[model samples]
Target: MSVGLTQPIWMEMALALLILPGVWCTSWLVLYQDVCAVRGSSVVILCTYHYPETLVNKNLTVEKVMWSHGRKQFFDGPFIIDSNNRTHTATKFEYVGNKVHNCTLQIHQVEQSDSGEYAFRFETNNGGKWTGSNGAKVNISELIISMTTPKVHGPIKEGDCVNLTCMNNCSSAVMWFRNGKPLQEESSTLYLCDISFQDSGNYSCSPKHHNRPLSEVIRVSVEYSPRNTSVSVWPSSEVLEGSDVTLTCSSNANPTLNYTWFKIDGDSCLEMVSQAELQFNVTHTGNSGKYFCVVSNKHGRQNSTILSLKVKDHAEGMAAVTLTILLAVLAVVPMIVIVPMVTWHLVAHRKKTTAPKPDTEENTQTTEVHVTSPTSDCSLTEERREEEPSQQDEVPYATVHITKQRANIQQQNEEATAIYSSIWEQQAKEDLYSVVSRPTPRGKQAQDDPVIYSTVFRQ
Candidate 1:
């Protein structure tokens, strides 16, 4: 059974040795011969004594019994127990005897200093005293576990044998333990064969007793090859293009080690970097594949399982989405401003060309207009009028009214009485002339900006 250092708790003993006396009488004192006990445990010495009923006038009444263990006197010492003066005795020792025969002594929480011979003494009512000279000897020893192994060439590796011995010359049967748990070993020599990492721990041993005491702890360390090799990837999710990724290799081993990385290319494996970690600045999908790692040391080597990788092309995907967004913007722009603006301009231009207003002269193309700057104005020519007075009186010119009104249509022969026709119809050519306006760079004007016309006719 497994045992731990507690407040002196109980245990399961495989065997028990009962020291019962079959017969006893006619002796003044009876004591145990010799015994062995462990530390932190209680020890009992089976003892008995006899005394006569009477000695002269004093009655042989055994009133007091005392015990001594490796001391000068059983009546006076630090390690003494008295039956009569139980209150004056120290708590470490107890005398469980009666007035008749039993003189058993009990020692609690035994230590190394408690190891020695134990003697018993008795006193009667009349001052009759007797002490047992042949005392029972008690051997005290502390238990511990010690280790021994063959000289290793380098280090104690797997499949090596280790021997663990219960120490301090402990003569009792002991149980071997590792890390507070009991093993199947019972003897003092514990054999560890084909030891591995599982065999490494703090080993101990304890004597087979109900109130057992554990030995001093001894650590056992075992070294072996790389085991449980594994690979870990940074950015554990989907990897993007133009990003950083790292893969790390790890294993359980003793001493120093070396790490090697690999990648599965198509159907074959390719050796990559030779370090504990490998970093890559991913550029394209070409960097996506299955990868693994191998760890090694002076003892042996091991390989890890494959880890899959895939790189996503983020740049190209963003470009395609950007083009789609620009196209959507272009499709909606014409409806918002361009189409409405062009429609407004075309409607304004068509109104200008189709119909002309009747009262406004600037919009009518049929009206003949005469415009002059402020510096050029026509004046009333009284001298020209005086020079052609006779011709002006003989030819009376018709008045022309300027208005923006459409005229009635007429045939050319019906309205042939123009000024040019009248001038060509003149029969007497006696230099007939009248004042006329000159169509040149110079002109005369009245204050009201008026025009005048004159003509000569033969009578």
Candidate 2:
């Protein structure tokens, strides 16, 4: 029974050797499913392979090792590298492995065309062949540049700073370009300091020392506040009354601006409107004053120069002209009505003074003559002559001697009455022409004396 057990154990050990070789061959060659690499960089593909231990014992050595692109049968696709023959090896690829089952591959200066599925094949001296059907795939990508902010779109203000970075699968020297010109920077990160309006342009980045694809273009815009603010007025600064006025504000700025119009009050500014231009109709002198405008944006604000306005009062000017004309008419009308009346009174007084007087007797009886009233007419009557004169020689004569005193007294009374009447008529004319009449003083009128005249004559 012991001998029979020993035979069965020997048969089982032989069977285990054959089965282990088959299992190892089937589950050998191990590597990652995919690999990512950047253009103009280097990459190392990690791999762990296996082979049957029975092959090593039988002295079956690896004769050839090859790597190829695409998924096809062994030795069917274009070969990328051959370890056995140095002449057939690719310059970019190298196999750094020992006699063990480690078959790692390294690629230098990777390019876009090198991206594809890659497989490994190995052949032994004992007519043994194996190929890793599940191989690592290479996916090549270009250098990517991005902003380290919340939003990628850039419109930064002047004097501000921004951060930029270059991204890739592997570490490499990166170059920056602005407006299609090299910036001479060799790092993964770039910082733009004290940006200005002139710095606005297209930007791109790529890896150095290789024909690497460039990143997408990034547009950068620079903004600034308003400058050189000014104001303009339509028509003119000094305008007539009842005219339309317009004021416009302008400035230089990057972003759009908001405008506000203000009028200068006594000691402060009063807001009038919120727009680029202010327009209103002027009606009177109240519309004339000082004004200004302000322009603002996200960056800063600016104030325009102050302006003044003038308006003429049309109604006041017309009223002044009318008053002058009325005064002139009043002065002329009084002269036209009073001059003719005064001239007529003077002519009548002259006629009364020059009229002929009746011839008086040279001698008359010496008798006292008296006139009681000033209005009674005085006449000389001829006395009856003693002897009747012939009809042919009709003459009436008086042989009586007249005293000079009586005749002189009678003539003086009549002259005095005429002068008094002329004086009273002149006083009445003066009262009619007086502009403002005033009552006489009570004491002054009582102090003056009254004069009376009487006329007496004998015939």
The global C-alpha lDDT for each of the candidates, from Candidate 1 onward, is 0.65, 0.65
Model 2 poorest 10 in a row by lDDT = 427-436
- At residue 121, candidate 2 shows an lDDT of 71
TM-score of each: 0.50, 0.35
Which segments of candidate 2 are over 4 A away from where they belong? 1-22, 25-27, 73-75, 146-157, 161-459
Question: How high a TM-score does candidate 2 get?
Answer: 0.35
Q: How much does candidate 1 score in TM-score?
A: 0.50
| Model 1, position 217: C-alpha lDDT score | 87
1-459: candidate 1 lDDT, tens digit per residue: 111111111131101111212211232445464667777667787776665464443456777777777636533444377665646748888777676878777888889998988877777675555666556788887876677787744466789889999965546578777888888778889988898888888888777653343688888888888988888899863577888999988899875689889999888989999999989888888999999998888889999878888887987658767999999999998789988899999999899877776753332222122221112113324665567565443433333332222342123213332222123224333333333332221232333222323332333
